[model samples]
Target: MISIKRFSELSYKEAVVLWNEGFKYYFSNMTMTVDAFIRKLANEGLSPEHSVVAYVDHVAVGFAINGFREMDGKKIAWNGGTGIKPEFRGQGIGKVLIEACLDVYREQGVDLALLEAVAQNERAIALYKKMGYEVFEELVFLQQNGAMTIDAFHTNSNFEIVRGIPEDIQLLEFFQPIKAWQVQVPGCKGAESIIVKKGNEVLAYAVYQRMMDEKHNIQTIALNQCEIKESIDVQKVADFILYHVFQPHHKIKRMVRNLSKNNRLVYNTLLAAGFETLVEQVHMSNRLDQPIKESIQ
Candidate 1:
């Protein structure tokens, strides 16, 4: 008999074993430790209550982690990760895990669910489509290395940049130039946020986490809201920081960032900067039409 259990019910070792086993099959050379998995869950805001493990006759056969938060007053959930043991393929375990996630979201009053499936994962994409999910956007993961030039407009001596504190960092939000999602670096607690100041006004900012990966992933870069409309000179700023700050400590093999289909700034900038598109993913979302509403007196 197949059954589902919350992630907290399993020991750390069990979760790691299950995760690593599935990852190795789906992704090449992917290895993760128990401590690393636990830390990722915590840092990415994944809770035990949001994860489910599938058990077949008391053996863990599959698992899924769903991370959620309220964005713009709407409950949104992301499928952080999900996998099934190799031996358990074609047994409908994957479908079961997805349903379990939906049930959990329903209980949490989530109006929308989101996940990114690699473009090559045809089976997973078809499964999501069958479950009433629709592809809303295509996200391209790109990477590049070596030093580049900084734009003179941003390099003006009057602008000031400061590293971020934990409290001040929380004010940052995703969907900006630098997404908040990239803050999930392995050991990074708080990221360094650079703010551009002209006189007493804050004009733009970029936040990034130093990645633990050998490539030194510069996780995120968000320009200030006002700078979005102006000629922010992202490439110049990125090139400057990449060469001066990150390149010294690391060889800068590659830096990866995701860009949505509609995001012209980063997508175009990355292309011009010679960051090759390594992979493409479809961003899927499911929303129940005519959501049931409850009235509060």
Candidate 2:
């Protein structure tokens, strides 16, 4: 027999083991200690009540992590992670896990459900599509080594690129709406940011978090959000923000992921600046309250 229970019911150590085991061979390493796992859950606003772990004959075998938030007054739920143990693969556990997630979404009044799958993970993508998700956008992860030649030069411009805090992100008039979950407003609250302004008019804004090694040496800087006013020169705005943000930390690794294809200006600018595409993903979404299409049903 199989059973699914709230992830909160599992001990921290138990959940940690399940997490590490479930994603042992995923596209990337997902192993985490109890502390790291708990910290990630807290930092990302993932819900213990909404998340689930599956059991077969009293043994933990699979899990799913979820997050919820209200954006522009619409309730959105994100499936942060869903994984099944190797031994449990080829069974129906994956579908059951998704159904459990939808149950939680409906219970929490989530109108839209969002998730991302590696573009090359056709099996997972097909499963998600069978579960009623439709592809809406393509997200790319761009990364570059700090030691690489960065030609982001300081430009003489009408606008002043000033360092700012996360609190100032809302002041930008042209923030993108359909951004990835982690780069959204709530995530910005925990990040450091910079913005461009001409006199009193805000033109563009960017936010990122710095990662430091044990010796407090700069290691990686992950750009969480970068937005530019379309009326202005895209390359110029990108150069201003990129140069100012990265000039001081030119020797560390810098990464920005989940950048949408819709933002061609910023995406192309990054490529022009020598950043390479590390990975690409398909952003898929579903409406919870609506009925699944007859074909899939």
- Name the best candidate (by lDDT): 2
Instruction: Judge candidate 1 against the unseen true structure and give its global Cα lDDT, from 0 to 1.
Output: 0.62
- Indicate which candidate wins on TM-score: 2
lDDT of 2: 0.81
lDDT of each residue in 168-202, candidate 1, tens digit only: 43454422422324332221355555554445544
lDDT of each: 0.62, 0.81
Please identify model 2 stretches exceeding 4 Å from their true place: 148-150, 213-217, 289-297
TM-score of 2: 0.90
Q: What C-alpha lDDT, on a 0 to 100 scale, does residue 5 get in candidate 2? A: 95
TM-score per candidate, in order? 0.74, 0.90
Worst 10 residues of 2 by lDDT: 288-297
Q: What is the lDDT of residue 202 in candidate 2?
A: 72
Tens-digit lDDT track for model 2 on 1-297? 779999999889988889988997889888899899988888789998889888899998998899998866678899999989998977988888998998899889988898999899899899999998998889999888866563553455666867768767766667665578878767665578888877787778888888888998878888888888875566677777877666533588889868887778778877877789988999889977565332111
